[model samples]
Target: MSLSFHIGFNGQCKEAFEFYAEYLNGTIGTMLEFKDSPVAASVTPEWQHKIVHANIVIEQVELAGGDVNPEQYQKPQGFNILLGVKSESKVKSLFEKFAIGGEVVLPPQKTFFSPCYAIVVDRFGVPWKFSCGK
Candidate 1:
């Protein structure tokens, strides 16, 4: 079986996927909103516009996400999605862009691990690890 990750957000699922597309430069596979599902009428009015399922491809990696249902909501945890960059400037640029209004877990710096590495929890509370090969 092939396993895949599905990212979740409080309410910014759509926005986050869209933002990632910019950096990923990949196509959005599909999106199914609550309003388009067979159970659309069963959802709360406030959640009708929220995405129930969506998919995106970045660097050939398929990334999918959706809003969690209250009955089965599971907050995202553990593993951080990593982006391997090719240069220090790229790592620095991405860190700055996503770190706004978020916490910096590790400042971008040269280390034994690599020439440059940084970790940040983005505005959406999703953690990202950036690094480059020496």
Candidate 2:
């Protein structure tokens, strides 16, 4: 079976996925809003515009996420989304994009295991580990 990760957001799933699509050269597919769901009536009007589900395809890999109920939302922890790229320049560019309004846990630099590597937590509170030239 193929495995895919489903992330939960407080309310920024749409924005985050859009940003990722742009920087990662991905295509966004199947964006559904809370109002579009069968249980739309159960969600508050304020949350109707929130994303219920979104899929972003990067290099044929699908990344999925959705906005969680406000009461149930929690910051992600313990794991990071690791991205393996083929070029150092691409990794640097992507790292810079992820650094906007984000925390840089580790700046891009040469590593023994790779040509370049970096770690950052994006504005959406998603941690990413980027490496290139493996």
Candidate 3:
């Protein structure tokens, strides 16, 4: 079985996914808003314009995300979306970009398993890990 991750956003699904697609050099295959979905009537008027679902392909991985009601939204914990990059320069660049307006859990550094490794919690509150398995 193939595994994928689905993130829950606090009314920032669209903006977050757009940023991800560009920064990760990924392709967005779907970006359905609540107003365009069948469950439009079930959400509040403000949520109608929010993203109901969005999916992006970063290489072979398909990442999905959606906007949830404020009351149902919670900060992400426990796991991080790890990206195995091939270039050390690329990893450093990504680490800097993600660290802007976000927390840098670990500055890019060489580790036993990878030449470059870093962790950052992005402005959208998503934690990411970057590594170059050289």
Segments of candidate 1 deviating more than 4 angstroms: 70-75
For candidate 1, the C-alpha RMSD (Å) to the true structure equals 1.8
Q: Each candidate: what lDDT?
A: 0.84, 0.92, 0.92
Clashes per model (N, Cα, C within 3 A): 0, 0, 0
Q: What value of lDDT does candidate 1 attain over all alpha carbons?
A: 0.84
lDDT of 1 at 37: 91
lDDT tens digits by residue: candidate 2, 20-96: 99888889998999899997998999999999989999888889999999899988899999999999998899999
* RMSD value for candidate 2: 1.1
Which tens-of-lDDT digit does each residue in 41-76 have in candidate 1?
A: 988999898888888888778888888766666556
Encode model 3's per-residue lDDT on 1-134: one tens digit a residue: 98779999989989988888888988999999999999999999988999999999899799999998999999899999999988999899999989998899999999999999999999888999999988
Per-candidate TM equals 0.89, 0.95, 0.95
Cα lDDT for residue 42, model 3? 96
Candidate 3 stretches greater than 4 Å from native:
none
Residue pairs that clash (backbone atoms under 3 angstroms), model 3? none
